[model samples]
Target chain A: MSVSALSRPSFSRRALLILLSVLLIALVVGMEQLAPLFRALFPDQDPAMYERESFLNLTLAHLALVLVSSLISVSVGVAAGLFVTRPAGREFEPLVSTLAAIGQTFPPAAVLAIVVPVAGFGFIPTLVALVLYGLLPVVQNTVAGLGTVPSQTLEAARGNGMSAWQILWRIELPLAMRVIIAGVRVSVIINIGTATIGSTVGAKTLGTPIIAGLVGNNLPYVIQGAILVGLLAIVTDLAFERLERRFSFGESGAMA
Target chain B: MSASHNPTRDTASARLVANRVLVTLLCAGLLAAWLLPFATMSPNRLASGQTVGLSEALSAWQAIALLALSAVLAVAALRRPLPRELAHGVVLLASLGLLLITLYSLGDYAQRTLVEKSPSARVSQGSAFWVMAFCCALAAIDAFQRASSGWLLRLGYMLIAGGSVAMLFASGHFDDLSIMREYANIRDNFSDQFITHLVLVGSALGPALLIGVPLGLLAHRHVRLQGTLFSVLNFFQTIPSIALFALLVAPLSALGNAFPLLGEWGIKGIGAAPAIIALVMYALLPVVRNTYAGLKGVPPATVEAARGMGMTARQVLWRVEIPLALPVMLSGLRIVTVQAIGLTVVAALIGAGGLGAFIFQGLGQYAIDLVLLGAIPTIVLAVIADFTLQMLVVLSKPAGTRR
Candidate 1:
């Protein structure tokens, strides 16, 4: 709120982190656009691309997989997180966190293979696995991020006669949004890569080109997918950092 | 502690209705999905008379034993008065066993298997084994846990509750490797394959961490280079190890072509060399990110105090910052290590070798037993690696920090 606070040394850190990020982003775009150059240099190589599917559809399908699965995961996971966090259900928090961790460590691709028979191939099966895979970070982060909200703030909200829902919506969630975002950042980035395996079961996404390239042994296609995902991850991370700084206490002990 | 665990003291019928029913339903849903082979796998596939070998049967038994052991410990954790020592011992043993198991499995699987199955088989099977192994592993870890120990012990209770779930699913297990082999159309050689799977996954992690840590440190220090380098590494990570390998294949093959020395070192386009490079490259982002985050997280005050007291920047950093930053750094390493173990399974896609070979091999031929040989151990390796690294992070945390 104060001008002096806004002008702290951290502003310089922010600028530096941003400037480098822009440079890297430019490098990634340059790489994508200059593929023809690489193709020429490596004369034996075929240019990387999809034959049947347009890149737009593939990108949309990829986004849908992430959005739908993450939405489902976050809805249930956050509900579970909020439920376990409350007085009536706080005791079950441990049970919930363990299940989440197990879900996380559970191999999504392997599960995808097994689930293919029951769920059938393509989007649904991959959706199921992605939902399961994405659940932990969201749920665990929700619980943790909320739990770390200052006790005084929560109590004050409760004392003001805020309904439990109101308290959650108005108080805890806003405070915890930074960590929740962090978890989302992690889940999103991981999903960016993990989604590539979806192609194995016939789920179309950017991963399809990469896997097709891998199977067909085409380097440029693989590079294209890798480069896209890498850029997506970097961009999301920087966005999250900016959001965290905007939303979070500027210095919450700076160490812990 | 036993006082807190009075499940018997609670209104028994109410507890059953409120908790047990939901868990049962959840388990049933999960099991119904997992047991398609029993419920819907083709009889024609079954009629081919695929048989389970005695070895595989024994291996499944071993898996059961480990699961049962975890169950017993869970029960004990809930009811009896466990001395602090045994609980602490469980944590230590679980931590150590996970590491040792992976290391041993890696060595075994790394050396080519007689069956021509590669290392991914081991990684996949390792993950499955640990799902049970570390569930029990974490379950029994009632000691030395702060925030999570309660959950760990509660997991023990959940595992105890799983008895009912395990009972419902018991028939599924009863069918044995022979039936699975017959239906899936594969050989029975169950136990050895599972064991081999375990070894491959367990061992791959050592190499991942071995290479990941120093590079992480380098990224942490070179802040100026962080942007390009981190993005490249992150790119490597995001591509998935399988695709990364495809990209690497031509380059590796080219190198192998140009330099005879590279060829002699098994550094060709396919197989282990490409696999390792891809895995290592995939490893860099997490390691580096964690290192940078950890190093950056050192308290400004602490550093300032150290420098104010007449220490060089280097000295102050080594003494004041690193020790404090360790917990977060190790946490990052923990994630990367477990991830590496899991990804190694997929590396089999590129002929990188691990437990995935068995899973893929089974998928290729529809062999359930071989799939189990791969899938189970990969899961086991996942559990073990996860818990072991988790324990390390916990141990490294400031005394009394919960979790």
Candidate 2:
């Protein structure tokens, strides 16, 4: 709460990361006013855009799709990983892994093809495909993270008379938390990229501009979409990195 | 370990239950195949039409043959203390045979029914047949995984299976299936798409390595630069392939215009230039990250020792560092290659002419088989690239590090 604390190295770094991201978003949303400059760059082509959706709206929609699907996938993936690692669920480990692998091998495009017919187009199919695509990394990392928790630590906890649930909640998961977060980080970043494909099925993401540009051969629309999505990804990634650093530093400090 | 795995304890009681379970699954799969539709007789590719069950689609003998194979697999499963290798072998044969038979019958059924219908009428393999084939393939892959075969052997099995299917094509068996019909329609364009897809992948990889390796070296040699470089590369990577393709269009077109020679070299806003450029951008993160990691993994003691031995820095890098780093770098390359193959499909959306052309065309027409024609090949390409590169990684690993 102190001004001195705010001046600390980590706090300043965190502030910088957030500030940069906000500025990037502001630039992207204001890109329409910069159309003249863009037109100057690509002088041979018409500067007009056919993209009906504004950059801001598409960016928000893309983020919403990513947020929803990522939440669902993380829960499902983490839960599945936790279950398989449990003594009672050990037998299903291979089954869980195999299913996740199968989910991944089927491409998002193919997933779209299959889902669109059954679920129809727009948000639902896109969400379904994103969830499927995102599930594998989260599950893989969760399982790997939990599995790699030093058995000696668990044994010590058990010796202290902690119940299995208490051991998992207070001990195992805390220690495995960083790795699990890394998994979620990878999954979310991947979803951010994959979610653009949603525009193909009319879910209205940043891909709207890209696809529209491709169709119209309007180069600037494509540039605007690409810049926004790219910046969003960078911001999200930087935010995750900052969080990871804080966790590692705080956890180590606590342990020491 | 040997003493604990007593012959009866390992096999007798649990094996009996497992065998019964396996047999039941096989029987159930067989029942589904027989009772459900094997092919659909559509008036056209877009129209949903009548479903033809296995018996109606295949000649009686062929239908009986499929039934017999599943039954035989069930009976084989019933054998106690079955050799693991034998179980895998039987599953492999049965599944491969099932796939071949289904493809043959698909063509045959189409020829029989569609010959009497309008020329535009299409006959495609239906849901039941796909389910049946998937069941068989899953069973086969499961058994293969359990069998613990070498990677080379597994790849060999795949080649043999694919070759047999190719032989069927040569023998004119698949000429009537709707997928084949589509292939025949676009046979000329198919090769061009295939070549473009390969070129896109190769072009992306070539520049990625050139740029990524040095960037990785720079990141490695300098600590402060690592995060900035990686975050930038990572940001580019996280942008969707479609978005990346879009992002490149304006700048590249501008660059091409500013320098007319660039335009002459075919560096316009859209097409191969943008697609390849986007792919290369995507390709950079993995290659750079891996190269850095690989170089970092070179033991500091080894470097120190090399320097102590009067070796120049360059000599140490080439002789000690690179040799040690080769395997990890190859593994990184493997990831990039697989990722690029999949991403290249998206590039096709930008008139770059890859498998995505068929996928988009199929999407526009709502033709599932046409989409599969594109989707399946892309998946195959990715899988093959993944597997082959994985093998190279394993082979390239230093002997001491071999697992």
Index of the highest-TM-score prediction:
2
User: Which candidate should be chosen as best, given lDDT against the real structure?
Assistant: 2
Model 2 Cα shift for residue B148 (angstroms): 2.2
Q: Mind giving the per-residue lDDT tens digits that candidate 1 earns over A111-135?
A: 6666653466678988888887787
lDDT of 1 at A108: 60
Q: In model 2 chain A, where is the ten-residue run with the lowest total lDDT? A: A247-256
TM-score of 2: 0.87
Pick by DockQ: which candidate is best? 2
True contacts kept of each: 0.24, 0.36
Q: What residue runs in model 1 are displaced by over 4 Å at the alpha carbon?
A: A1-39, A45-49, A252-256, B1-42, B46-239, B285-333, B361-372, B389-403
- Pairs with backbone N, CA or C atoms under 3 Å apart (clashes), candidate 2: none
Per residue, candidate 2 scores C-alpha lDDT tens digits across A71-187 of: 999999999899878754553566567766655655566666566654667899889888888888889878888887887887788779888889889987877777788888888
